[model samples]
Target: MHKKILLAYDGTEEGRVALLECADIAHLLRAETHLLAVMRVPSGVFLAEGFVPDTVMEDERQRIRETIDDGVALLREGGYSAYGHLACGEPVEEICRLAAELGVDLIVLGHRKQTSFASRWWKGSVGISLLERAPCSILVAVGT
Candidate 1:
């Protein structure tokens, strides 16, 4: 039984499904669900491009908030207790760090769109990396 669970959401097709799965598991275990969305922010790249505009960061924050609000609404509609959190930085690293900080019992991750041999052979899966590094149990919800 999980008392606390972290759901990593990328807002992709499969990620949405994983959110639902996380909510389901949360409901069953009576666990508190944390929905985490990590925004990919370019660190050195922005500074290299001279000065960063204020609107850029503001726009990103607004988008992140909207995503979290919508996700929270969906979970509540499904009768699941959920909370949303948005972080900026590398996705996998932030996810792992958050899991550790929050002390969650499990980390629920989403599998990206499936690809054929050629695609899979070219682009590696981040899910595998997260599963390998996460200290807690990982449940990968596959398929979009």
Candidate 2:
């Protein structure tokens, strides 16, 4: 029985589905929820540039905050004790870090969605690496 849970919400279709599932599980376990939205910094050019511009950083921060806000609203309206934060870094790293920091017994996330050929070919892989490395147990929810 988990007393605390860490949930990953990225404002994606799959992630939204996971939130509903996490709510069900959390209610059953009477767990407190901690939602995390990670803003992944580009590992290529952005890292080499040393620092991101204030305008770009703020844009990303606001987006992440909105994601967290949505998650917080769901949990609150559902009568769950919930907290959330927006983080900047590698998505996988930040998610895992927040989970451990929260001392959660469970980490919840959605499986990555399939992408179009152009994106699949050009973009980086989804951060599924967190599943393999997380210290706590993970529950993956499928999208509708």
In candidate 2, where is summed lDDT lowest over 10 consecutive residues? 40-49
Q: Per-residue CA lDDT of candidate 1, range 1-85, in tens?
A: 7999998876777888898788889988989888998877655537656855678877887888788888888988887778899
Best by TM-score: 2
Error of 2 at 86 (Å): 1.3
Estimate the TM-score for candidate 2. 0.85
Question: Model 2 over residues 1-144: C-alpha lDDT tens digits?
Answer: 899988888878888888998999889989999898888765453555697777777887897898899889989999999999888887778887887787889988887765787775676444457657787988888875
Model 2 shows how many backbone clashes? Answer: 0
What does the lDDT read for residue 5 in candidate 1?
A: 93
Question: For model 2, which pairs clash?
Answer: none
Off by over 4 Å in 2: 43-50, 115-127
